[model samples]
Target: MIGKLGQTSRRYRDDARSATSRRLVIGATGVLTALLTVIQIAAMPAGPTPVRHPLAQGSVWDSVYTAAQAARGEATFRKTCAACHGDSLKGIDDAPPLTGTEFHKSWDGNSLSAIFTKINNDMPSDNPGTLSKPQVAEVVAFILQYNAYPAGKADLAASADSLGGIKFLPKP
Candidate 1:
């Protein structure tokens, strides 16, 4: 009976030691996993930052285009867009007007980039995608001039990013 009791106690000690070792291994593995996750996150590259321009700080009410640029745009419009939109920018047939109530309803609260892209990709019904970026910018300037938007000293840039920053608000 004495020997049997000793054997049982020894077995219990062995079992306890085994359980402790198992706990230690599990704890170590959990800590290692957390450390690896942190390291992986730290090693990853950051995302690209957005570019901001001082000229595009506000809506179109801030005079984002030059009068000279608008004149150039008007010339281009006469040569390429007048036939469909009319010499005075009133809609003719299927072509939509670029001024007044209809124009404001269609374009207000939108970005200038929206109109620039539409004109760049789909103007001059006979020759879509033929106008250059600068020409498109000029055309947009002319439209803004006709809508009674004030002119700035700088010409409107031919950049989509820049235009995207300028909002087409209602006349102000």
Candidate 2:
């Protein structure tokens, strides 16, 4: 009877040790997983930071482009953009429209600088990045005019920093 009792006690001890080992392994795995997650998050790249320019304080309604500039932009558009964007500024196959409600839906509340950058970087589809900064500004001016935005005495500047300050709001 004594020997049988001792064997039973040993079995219980072994079972308890196995349970403790399992708990320790599971706790260690959980901690390791948390540490790995923290490390990965720390290593990830941050998103784009919002740029704040003093000139960007005004909206496009403030007459940021001149009529002369818009005319120049229109000429450039005819030569460079009409094939894809159409004579009416309506989009052709795979190209998006650049005026009216579609334009507002895409660009409302965004900065002129954003559109300027896009034009400078990605316009003319087939001949991307070919337009000079001044040309891009002119194109933007023309687009504003086509949308019936009021013209000012000053031409739209080619400076992205300055353009960045002007917000593109839906026509009032």
Model 2, span 1-172: residue lDDT tens: 9999999999999999999999999999999999999999999876687443444348887778899999999999999999999999998988889987887899988889899989998898899999999999999999998988778888998978887778887544
Tell me how candidate 2 scores on lDDT: 0.88
Against the true structure, candidate 1 has what lDDT? 0.89
Clashing pairs in 1: none
**What is the TM-score of candidate 2?**
0.65
Summing lDDT over every window of 10 consecutive residues in candidate 1, give the lowest-scoring window: 49-58
Angstrom error at residue 111, model 1: 0.5
Task: Give the C-alpha miss distance for residue 149 in model 1, angstroms.
Answer: 0.2
